[model samples]
Target: MENLQMLMYGFTVALSLENISAAIFGAVLGLIVGALPGIGSLAGVALLLPLTYKFNPTTAIIMLGSLYYANMFGGAFSAILINIPGDGPAVMTTLDGFPMAQKGRPGQALFTSNIASFIGGLIGMFIVIFTGPSLARLGLNFGPVEMAALLLLAMTSIGWLLGENPIKGIVTTAMGMLIATMGMDAVRGVPRYYFGSIYLMGGVPFVPLVIGMVGFSRVIGLMTDRKSAPPITERLHYRDCMLTAHDFKRLLMPSIRAGLIGTFIGILPGAGATTAAFVCYAFEKRFKSEEPLGTGAIEGIAACESGNNAAAAGAFAPLLALGIPGSGTGAVLLGGLMMWGLNPGPLLFTNHPDFAWGLLASLFLANLITLAISWVVIPILVQVLTVPIALMIPVIMTICVVGSYSVTNSMYGVLIMFIAGIIGYIMTELKYPTSTLVLAVVLSPIFETDLRRAFLISGGSPAIFFQKPISCVLMIAFFIFLALPIIKAMWKRMRSSKGGV
Candidate 1:
């Protein structure tokens, strides 16, 4: 009841003319930026952050919050229409979304993504409202040891599930880890694999690498196969995009499950929407989908999209209650908070109830606003699938180059994009899963940093992982996942031997 009263007060603040206008503007701008590959929420929020400096803290945060929340909705636009992902979390969306588009149901795919994202974000917002401080406290328990163990399980389990050939998956996963290690050592601050280039000192930039691996590689494919037809040759109207009753049923359960799980994952330190999406998709793979994942299954799309959006919403718990950024974008928001002279911590809600609750209220408003905007815009966005390959190649190439160069304002990022594109194309030909490699690149650094910190805290003793309850549980799960294939293989061999005898 107290929470409800506070929320009503927050509504009063959020619904004011200035705040509502800011929310709408942020939601619209976020959609445009998120639909563009490589320019994700972090960059989008950071770029717009300075403009909010002169505004009141409440109004400033409401706009940025809306932008960040709406970005999750807009990311699926590109991932579903083209093969490219608009942001990191949308990487999982591309696995099923692109395939669904190819299967001549681009409209339905977009509908599923948007609806699932809405459901997920709604669930996350409710959870955050009721359990914000408690959830943040739970996240505090995930120290270095626990985080390392959890990441290990996620990497190994998801990597194994990604590819048909387990050996190839392991090899590619290792390859990504190697590439991630090229920059300065996380603990010692010494360059390990610079190979004589000063640019390697900073390591490979993630935005360029992702754009090259996922987006530019498609451009390369289009250039090589100029005669290939567009994915959607027929005209698609808004009416054609409506989901069937059965499709909604297929989407609902997964969205609900992922929303619940993703919210919790979001509250964990450094386990952002991308990781939540990957973990939720992997979890969904254990269930029976109407169609195989990566082949345009609705379940696959629902799980990852919902998971990412929910994680985006739940990320606010840690930021508001603990002053700890749950993701890179959250870090940017934290900076904005400090800059506005509003300290975010235990006293935030007590000291500035209006600012704290208004931001939360703005998220709910943004979720609805973004959903309405996406529904209106999707019909136009899906028309991109009908464009000729010849025209798309140059346009996509320009996006790749601009997105990459924009990250660092250097040609070095563009160079990395081209190199990664070549490698991604070759890997595609060789049938190696680029997704596995990209996931590894994203998670390995976190794993390495946490592992080193854990070890340092424990005087290099391996038992430190088992000493903590959370780390022990995660480590156990990791070993179980690692050994499951071997156990199954041995069981099969034993059964075959008995039959032969």
Candidate 2:
């Protein structure tokens, strides 16, 4: 009841003319920023942080918070309409979203993504409202050992994403891990695999690599196959894009399940929306889907989209309660809070209840605002599928170059993008799973850092992972996943031998 009263007080502050206007502006701008490939929420928030210097801290945070929250909604637009993801978390969205769009239900796919994001954000906000500080404390229990074990478990999901060829999948996964290793060592801060180039010392930039591997590679395909027809030829009306009752039923359960799972993942230190999305989608694979994942299944889209959005909301728990940044964007927001002279630790709620709660309240308003805007624009965004391959090639290629270049304002990012694009194209021709490789790249650095830290904490002893309760449980889960495929193979062989006898 007290929490409810505080929230109601927050609503009053958030509903004020200046605060509400800031939120609306932020929501509109966030969608545009998020829809543009490579300019993710981190960059978006960072770039805009300076502009909020003059506003009252409460209104300023409300605006930036709204932008961060709405970015999750906008990310799905490009992932569904094109094969490109507008942000890291949206990468999983492309697996089902683009395929579904190709199957001629682009509008429905967009609608599904929007609705799932809304549901996930709602659940995450409620959790944050009631259990924010406690959840932040829970996250503190994940030390280096536990984090390493958790990442190991996440890496095991690569096997599931590898498609039909285990060998190729393993190879690609190894390649991704190798690529991830090129940067400076996490613990020692020493550069490895740079091969004498100063640019290589920084390793590969993620935005360029992802844009290259996913977006630019598709551009290469379009350039090669210019004669291919567009995915959709018929006119699509808003009515046609609306979800049916049966579709909603399919979307609801997965969204709810992912919401719960994603919120928990988001609360864990350093496990952000991308990991949440990957984990949720992988978890969804364990269940039966109407259509198989990666082939336009509604369940796949709902799980990932919902997971990412919920994780976005859940990320705020640590930020508000403990001043710990759960993700890169959170780090930027942390900086912003400091710049505004607002301390963001345990005393924040007590010291500045209006600022803290108003930011929380604005998320609810932003969620609704973003959803409404997405619904209005889905019909228009779906038209991208109707554009000719000949025309889309150059356009997408431009986006890839601009997006990659924007990362560091250098040719190095663009160069890396081109090389990764070529490699991605070849990987496609060779039937290697690019998704597995991308996932490996995303997770390996975190895994390596935590694993090394765990070893250091244990004085190079491997037993450190088993010493901690949480780490032990996670390590056990990892080993079980590692053994499952071998066990299944052995069982099949035994059955065959018995039949022969």
Query: Using lDDT as the measure, which candidate wins?
Result: 1
How many backbone clashes does every candidate have? Answer: 0, 0
**What would you estimate as the lDDT of candidate 1?**
0.80
Listed in order, each prediction's TM-score against the native is 0.63, 0.62
**Which regions of candidate 2 fall more than 4 Å away from where they truly are?**
1-117, 128-133, 158-173, 222-363, 435-446, 486-501
- Candidate 1: which stretches are off by over 4 Å? 1-117, 128-133, 165-170, 222-363, 485-501
**Which 10 successive residues of model 2 have the least lDDT summed?**
157-166
Per-residue lDDT for 280 in model 2?
95
Tens digits of per-residue lDDT, candidate 1, 280-378, equal 999999999999999999999999999999999888886787565566577567756765788676567778889988889889999999889888877
lDDT agreement with native, every candidate: 0.80, 0.78
